[model samples]
Target: MRILLALLYVSLVGAPGGSSLPANDSFRNTIQSILNIGQITLFHIKKLRTKLPAAPQMEFSTPSIDGLTSISRDLQILDNELQNPVTDLLSQIQADVSSMEGRVRLFALTMGCPVQARPRGHPWASLFPDSHFYLILEKVQRYLDTIFLNKDKLKVC
Candidate 1:
């Protein structure tokens, strides 16, 4: 009886069949890739901007226009890569992230917490208290914000 109970306990706790561990890892990897792409984009943008001659109108010169077009193409590729639903892990992560965001928002509203507090140490933050999910979402958001704020920095490389 004791051995049977122990075997059952071990099976329940150690099995991966019911776990989202793989999905979590995939999400983390995706977020890291996004951040790396953002860094590369920023670098390209800065290089192009620095190479430009100093003139208000010259900012939109031929070279700059060409660089911008290249940058745009790179961005499109990145967007397509992100949008591809090739892996079940990514799809699950995306769905979970969206659902978690919704739940966080709802919880915050119910608890009277500010929107900014939804990501971190807020009363309602515990709604999606899973560390892996939170970390992936936070990284994704950070990368997205960096891309948005440095939009002009994305130059053709």
Candidate 2:
């Protein structure tokens, strides 16, 4: 599962060594791919909730998944046109998403959380990539934030 996710990320985000962006699906498919990965990650996390240890809730508050619903509804309600400010904000948010995901990757390695494959026809991928990609990516960011903030929740014993 990790390998699958990695391949998808590399395909979409491209290699760090590249001198320029790979020019691969920079607009449409790139957004869709991110959405697909985000949806897949959420589905996997839901399944792993049982397999993984409980996260810390004493000092840090885990982000609520409910946020995604409103974000999604907002996206659906949006007209075909997107505002310049909104697009700019999404780009910045994507950068934060990337950073958060990076931190979570290390914690994921240490936790050794195993991912069960998403069931077939499970709507594991997002539909119609748009600004909603940011919404989905925001969801992924929240999951990563939860994992990174509770990095010590896993025990060796």
Q: In candidate 1, how many Å is residue 114 off?
A: 31
Q: Report the C-alpha lDDT of model 2 over 1-157, residue by residue, as the tens digit.
A: 9999999999777655562455333423433443454455555545544554554332323343232232222222221112223334334333434433333333334335432221223132335444344444444446544533443332210
Predictions: Cα RMSD each: 18.8, 19.3
lDDT of 1 by residue, 1-157 (tens): 9999999999998877656787567545644454454555445434544654432321111212122233233333223322323323334334433343343344334434444322222122224333323333334344445454554333212
TM-score of each model, paired residue for residue: 0.30, 0.25
lDDT of each candidate versus the true structure: 0.39, 0.39
Count backbone clashes in candidate 1. Answer: 1
Candidate 2 Cα errors over 4 Å, as ranges: 1-117, 121-128
Candidate 2 pairs with clashing backbones: none
TM-score of 1: 0.30
Error of 1 at 106 (Å): 29
Worst 10 residues of 1 by lDDT: 57-66
